[model samples]
Target: MSGSDVRMSAWGAVGLVAGREVSTRVRSKAFLATTGVTLLVLVAFTLVMKFLGGTGGADATVGFAGQTSVLEASLKATATSVGQEVETRAVADEARGREQVSDGDLDALLVGDGTSIQVVVKEELDAELRTALTVLAGNIELNQQIVDLGGDPGQVNQRVSQAAIDVRPIEAPRDFNGEQMVLGMVAGILIYMSLLINGQSVAQGVVEEKSSRVVELLLATIRPWQLMAGKVLGIGAVGLLQMGVIGGVGMGLAMAVGALTIEVSAAVGTVVWLVVWFLLGFVAYSLVFAALAALVSRQEDVGGVIMPPLLLVILGYVLGISILPGDPGNRLVEVLSMVPLFAPMLMPMRLAMGGVPAWQAGLAVVLVAALIPALVWLSGRVYRNAVMRSGAKVKLTDALRSA
Candidate 1:
């Protein structure tokens, strides 16, 4: 920056600083390395999910022996009706089928020449498979009884199959989509990594300049808040771009690979929300990080200064990742996600889970948005007061009081 830069307006100074940061960091090898690593990880994940069949693996494998081969399709349909995916294979005879089951080639084997459904398992039967088999056996018995009574067994079974209870739910329950759950989880991981990594980039940048006394030189031209805001905005822009690329490319790969079978709109919505929350979370956390980092001129002490807020980020992510997958309606996580401090990590995950009320999502965004101005004022004061004073770690009270 030149001496004439001191005479520039605040916007001009900030733009100049921001421009410098963007140009410098975007060209750096660290940025390239991290972005490359992230993209590779995404590609690997997409491929793995595609190969593994995208959140639906066979619940069990069943082998049909002898004349039981005719029963394979009905058995599969029955398993599916009970929310199980049972893959079936043919065996030459009951002896071979039992051997396959014992050798773990199949989860269960059907035997006894298809007169009735008989299963042999190496161990105990799975509860789900048991339910499906019980239902199948009941249908068979009912058909036999109808045949003995001279009724059309097929017509009677069809009527029985069509019987469904009239469900009168007061409010419709949200059916969590498989794709949404996976997408939400991926969203959480992406945002958490972004905030932890890029948020620190903001702080480390501040400490590096201060420790190197480069801040003093820069300050000669630009005002303190302008310098601070420029750093945040500049780094933020780069991070946002990087994040957008990862989210877009990851979603695209999943879609192309058939791993994400959801509608394009849902996938696009997830990416958009990911970007939105990232901006909000990044700005909110970066402001505080930049301010706290100003208190300590050394890179090592930056961690000490930022640990409290860092824990909040980690806590939010942990709660979201651990609990939300099991119980997306977790009350505590729901309430905490509404808090601005935790919203960045948790809200995006819940949003990706695909059933959040419109008001709730809007409120979380609004809360975080409202908190940004307060952070700007508070962070600006500490950054301004402490950025110029470098040496031993400055007390938080002194930074605030002196300002």
Candidate 2:
């Protein structure tokens, strides 16, 4: 009986192929090792950020000698106001404080007659530390001047501290912060790795089947597009599982350890958007990968055949990684992010950073969504025409022109 006249339905054939791919891939040692290493790194990072010493420690340590210890609170407040964390320690005397500074135990030593701020450093103070000390020194002079002029130092200092510059922005962002920016970069990394790994997996799988003459036998029972679709969907399903596990576990662990100060909902939202973009990007890119891969029978030829589409993936990732972390709202990046080719990698990063308009996000999704059907038709044609023609690289023109 002919393969088409067999008992199985078309969907059944696709499912069988997909199931085989999923079973084969998940059993591989490389997948298990990579996933395990990723989890361990995520967990280790969370631990270090929360419990172990990370950036949470003070930036500089200042030693106070004698009566200068009275200025501890004020000096610390000044440093904190400028986003510098200063740890204050009491010293027995100027001699000991200088010793500590020289030994690098203290960043600077504060020693004076309690009348003004004085600093002794091993060499020069850090620029940020210098800024903090300068502000504190100026405040001391201003306070003493106020006292001599018969004005209340406390009241004057309070007013000066309360004063702040007011700025009015033309357009306010919907939601954006340092935390969100970090999440955006993480999202970009996850999507980029996912696309690169899984897309290449599809290509290699295609070339492997073709090079081994396995495609001939598979085509005897299943249609070319079904086999291609099944492989893509199957590998994508496994990759999606990996992405969810890694993202969900990492973010969940970060939240659980209190390492992440952002709202829980924000973290969850980032994970959801990450998964969405991965799915969109994988399906979109893998189609082209499979098609291009079919043009090459040998595994060695796969890279060259797939380089053009691979460049698109790399370009989107590079642009998003390079630009979004610094300028989330670059006009060029924002515009390119809307294009279907770039949307899969760039849009997710933008979404994590927030301030992406609802309409714009929706439109990017729609654009990529619209591109898939065209890819399916075009890619299916190339794969069908080229998959059975082994031993030499198939030209695109010939693939397209074949009946």
* Counted clashes in each candidate structure: 0, 0
Provide the global lDDT of candidate 1 against the true structure. 0.91
Assess every candidate by TM-score.
0.88, 0.89
- In candidate 2, list every pair of residues with a backbone clash: none
Q: Write the per-residue lDDT of candidate 1 for residues 175-240, one digit (tens) a residue.
A: 797788999999999999999999999999999999999999999878899999999999999999
Q: Which parts of model 1 are misplaced by more than 4 Å?
A: 1-6, 54-73, 87-114, 118-131, 146-152
C-alpha RMSD of candidate 1: 3.4
Q: In candidate 2, what residue range of length 10 has the lowest lDDT sum?
A: 48-57
